[model samples]
Target chain A: MLQTLTFFALAGLVTIFALGTLVLRNMFHTFLSFLGCLLSVAGVFFSLQADFIGGVQVIVYAGSVAVLIVLALLLINHKSGDLSRTNLWSHKWLGGVIAAVLVGAALFGVIMFTHFTGLPLTGETAAIEPVPYIELADGLLNQYPVAFEAMAMLLLAALVAAIITTQADDKADKKAE
Target chain B: MEFVNNIFVNIADLCRALFVWLLNLLGLPVGLAEVAMVAVYWLGIVIVCVFCALFYVIWERKLAGYIQRRPGPNRLGPNGWFHTVGDAIKLVMKEDIVPDGADKNVHLLAALLAFVPPMLALAAMPFGEGMTALDLELGVVYIMAVTTLASLPVLCAGYASNNKFAMMGAMRVVNQAISYEVPQALCILSVIMVAGTFNLNQIIDWQTGNIWLVCLQPVAFVVYLITALAECNRAPFDLPEGESELTAGVFTEYSGMRYALFYLAEYCNMFVAAGLATTLFLGGFTGPFLPGWVWFLLKTFVIMSFFIWVRWSFPRIRADHVLTFCWKVLVPLMLANVLVTGVVVYLLA
Candidate 1:
């Protein structure tokens, strides 16, 4: 009963924050809302007993990715005066339609395909034990070694690419000077 | 000795029983008893966090004064014991100022949120034998995750303040936090490799069964200490709020209780870092005589004193040097430490 209530509460929070992210005029406020949304999603994951994934979600998305995005936003929009104007979309309707369609598709897919195992679909409370981290690690490293290694390689490539692009910018600045 | 060691556990059980009994007597659902117990546990942790912050703040000042051959905060009370309490009162009584140009909502929110990361990180930390508040299986990861968000509130404060200094400080915070987190995580990874578990309690158990992890992975221990100092924004890596350059950095525009919250959060983060070091390296709650909780506090205070000593002893490094050192020096060293530890653990297994 408590888990169900907690999950629904978090889901409500996620919805509110996600909407706030889209509806907020100021870019920074939008970012904060987006962060709230991410954290609430992580809370939902935790409610479902996916502790490892929840932790990674917070660490990766809310921690690194969100910070990077905000940093970039601040760098690009140096003037506080322009904060409100920066988040204005040129094609608002198109963007809204695209977002709506994507969300609808995701919802449709989940409703059609995914099985809600051990979840309290009805009003009955279910006891779901958390999956041990060791088994999770074993599955990732042994069962899906290729995918894991590939993901690492992809991240490394992205890092190197970022470094190269920044270096290239520095070189071009020197050339211009 | 055993009873003393398990004093907190016994108290906790007693409280739970009392709560359950009361709920039963009142004809209430027994499930609410667990929720009430959680609230009590949270209250206890809040008390611990506040006291830890207050004690450490005064201790840091006293240590700093001694380092400079002077008495610190001696006027407030005996040995300036009540200095922090007075300061807390003063902070509370002071005028709360929000800059006209600042985002008022974010400015206010930042102060409240600054307390979240450290408090959340504390939830996973094992203070003594069977004294963890949350006791999550992925305690290490949870700590790392929450601590990573420590930069977020600072960033919000900087951006909201509409001050260039605050903005610069926020940028440095993200830079330093992200950079140092690599080495810190890698250091923890090495310990995880040796312990073969992410659970903080199990890690402590592993240390108790064997030897302290510091002896096995000295490099990781040292690296962890350095990165932890950096992670907590302690000198000489305190570039984020470098007073000399940024005039209190992200805290430039904050005043009154809001500023106090930030200050308290910094000390709390330091305490959490020290607690983590004690757990990860100093064989948490393990020692002769005394009790588990006492040993834990002793170890944590020792680590915190070391932190304060380092803060006063060293000069702040350049921002670029800090990042360069983390990536060039600490990261590679920790990666090697992780690799070597992994290989050794595999062989032993």
Candidate 2:
């Protein structure tokens, strides 16, 4: 009963924050809402006893990714007057179409792939045993090596692209000077 | 000896029994009773953390004064023990200021959120034998995850302050934090590889059964210390708040109680870091004569003193140098350490 209540509470929070992320005018406020969304999603995972995934969610999304987004925001040189205008509704129809399609696809994936289990109305289900980290590691490295390596390569490519882009900008500035 | 070792465990059990009995008398459900116990545990942790932060601040000042050949805050109480108490009162009584053009809500929120990560990290920390608050299986990962969010509040403060210096400090914080975390995670990974568990308690048990990880994995221990110092934004790695350059950095616009929250969080972060070090490397809560809690605190204080010593002894490095050193020197070293540990573990298995 408590777990169910906790899950619904976190899910509600996640929905509110996710909406705030989209609707908030201020970019910084929007980012904070997005962070809130990510953290609440992690809370949901923790509620489900997916401790490792929940931790990784906080680490990757709320920690590294959010900071990266903020850094990018800070890097953009904008006057105080332009601050509020940054997140104004531009290309609204296109954005709406894209968002709708993305959400539809996610819903479709969930409906198609997820296995839903019915819970008892009263009392508690037996406590779920946590998967050990070693088995988790083995599953990633051995059972899903291709996916793991592909992710690693994708990240490496992104890192290299970032470095190259910055280097090129530096060279361009030198030439202009 | 057994009784001494289980002292905290006994106390905790007594509290839990009393709490459950009271809840039963109130006709609360079993599940609600358990939830209430968790809340009680969190309350206990918060109280302990606040007192720990207060103690650490005064301790850091006294140690700094000693290092610099001066008496620090000796006027208030014996060896200025009540200095932090007075400071806390003064901070509370002072005016809370939010800068003009600042994001008022975020400015306020940042101060409150600054305390969250450290407190969350503390939840996983096994203070003594069988004394962890949460005791998650993924304790190491959970600590890493929460501590990673430590940069967020500073970033929010910087952004909301509407100050260029604060923004710059925030940028440096993100850069430094993300960079140091790689090595820190890797260091923890090496310990995890050796101990064969992510559970902090199991790791401590492994250490008790064998030798402390510090002796087994000395390289990882040293690297972990450096990364931990960097992680906590202690001096020599405190470019985020380099007072000489950024005038208190992300904290440029903060004052009074809000600033005190950040200050308290910083010491608490240090305490968590030191606590992790004691658990992972210093044979947590396991010593000959002293009780487990006493040993844990003793080891933790030793590590905290080392952090303070290093802070006062060294000068801060340049921002670029800090990043370059992390990526070029620390990352590769930690990677190699992990590789070596993996091979050793495989061989031993």
Candidate 3:
């Protein structure tokens, strides 16, 4: 009962905020609404009892990523776009239709799988107790060391790529001078 | 250990059990009782925040006065014990002003964003054995994550106010707070590697009858202290709120209750930082010959006073120096400490 209530509450919040992000006219307000969407999704993770992932969601996604987005927005210093040109059946109509169809297909897939497989209607996937954090760490480090190493390597590569691009931009500016 | 077990731990548990029993007797559903427990837990944390702010604000002033050889707030009650409460009332009575150009909703939300995170972080703070409001398994990570939210309100207040100084201060705060967090997290990782758990209670438990992590990882201790000072925006790391340059910085346009909430949050953040330092390094609530809670308070105050003293004594660092020092010096030092500590812990085990 508690899980269902939490799911509905958080799901409603997520939907509202996601729509707010799309509907808001002001750019900064849109960013704030997007942050609300991210946080409500984190709440969904918490309600699902994936505490570790929920925490990482807050720390990594809502905290760092959202701040980075705001900072990027600040750098551009752009305000609200012109609302006069937002006709629904204009040049972007195909993009909207395709996005809606994609979302509908995903939803249909989820509903069909759950209905046909006799799975729980609620969001939880399994009844087993959560693997303790220690065991999770142990499994990652010992059992799936290669996967862990690959993840770390991917992050390192991203860092290096970012530094290289910034350096290249600086050198190009120097050359232009 | 005996002192700790016999004091607030038992009392806290007994009070909780009694509350649960009373709710059950009143024919409340178990779920309602659980919700009530969580509510009481958060309420207790907020009460602690207010209580800490009340005492620590005055304590900070009194200590500052003594260090500077002057009396501080000696008029209200005995030695101005009521000064903070009086100031709080004054703040409540004062008119709240939002600048004409301010984004009203964002400004309001900024004050709340600034105020709530420190209180939330306090929920993980352990006063004594079993005395935490919520003893989650990932207490350390939870504290770090919640405390990171502190920077957001500064950003919001800066942007929403549409003020130049506020904007500059907010930008500086983002850089300082985010950069210092790296060293802070690394320092915490060293302690976690040693204690082998993220639970604050379990970390303290590991320190019982053992040398505290400070002794084991002194470099990390120093790094943690510096980063913590930076984290709380206390001087000499308080460049973001530099009075000489920015005139109260991100809170330049704030007034009355909004200002008071910011003030309360700052002091509460100080208490939280000092409490964390004490727990991780000084072996929280573990001392000879005193009640556990009293010892905890004493150690926490000692660390807090050190912060106050440093704030009074040192000049503020330059804005550029703040980021450079953390990234170039503290981060590397903390990284090395964590690496060495990991090796040592592994060898010993």
* Residue range B1-349, candidate 2, lDDT tens digits: 8897887678777877887788789888645666667887888789879989999999999999999999887989887889999999999999999988898999999999999999999888998878888888889999999999998999999989999899889889899999999999999989999998888999999999999999988988899889888888889999889999999999999999999999999999999998999999999888888888899899999999999999999999999899999999999999999999989889989
User: What tens digits encode model 1's per-residue C-alpha lDDT throughout B199-241?
Assistant: 9999999999999999998998888889889888889999989
Worst 10 residues of 2 chain B by lDDT: B29-38
Cα miss at A53, model 2 (Å)? 0.5
| Fnat values, candidates in order | 1.00, 1.00, 0.40
Residue range with the least summed lDDT across 10 consecutive positions in model 1 chain A: A81-90
CA lDDT for candidate 2: 0.88
Docking verdict class for candidate 2: high
lDDT tens readout by residue for model 1, A1-177: 777789889989999998888678788988999999999999988888889999999999999999999888877775553444324444556776788799999999989898776775465446677867788879999999999999999999999999999999999999999
What CAPRI-style quality would you assign to candidate 1?
A: high
Question: Residue-wise lDDT of candidate 3 within B1-349, one digit each (tens)?
Answer: 5755576556555666877788789987655655666777777787888899888898989999999999888999987888888999999999999999888999999998887888888888888766888888888888888888788888888888878888888888888888888999998899999998888988998999678878898888888889999988889988777889999889899999999888888899988898999988889988787777788899988999999999999999998888889989998888788788878888999
Model 1 interface RMSD over true interface Cα atoms: 0.5
Superposed by TM-score, candidate 2 places the C-alpha of residue A172 at a distance from the truth, in angstroms, of 6.2
Best by lDDT: 1
- The candidate, 1 or 2, that scores higher on DockQ is 1
Query: In candidate 1, residue A143 scores what lDDT?
Result: 100
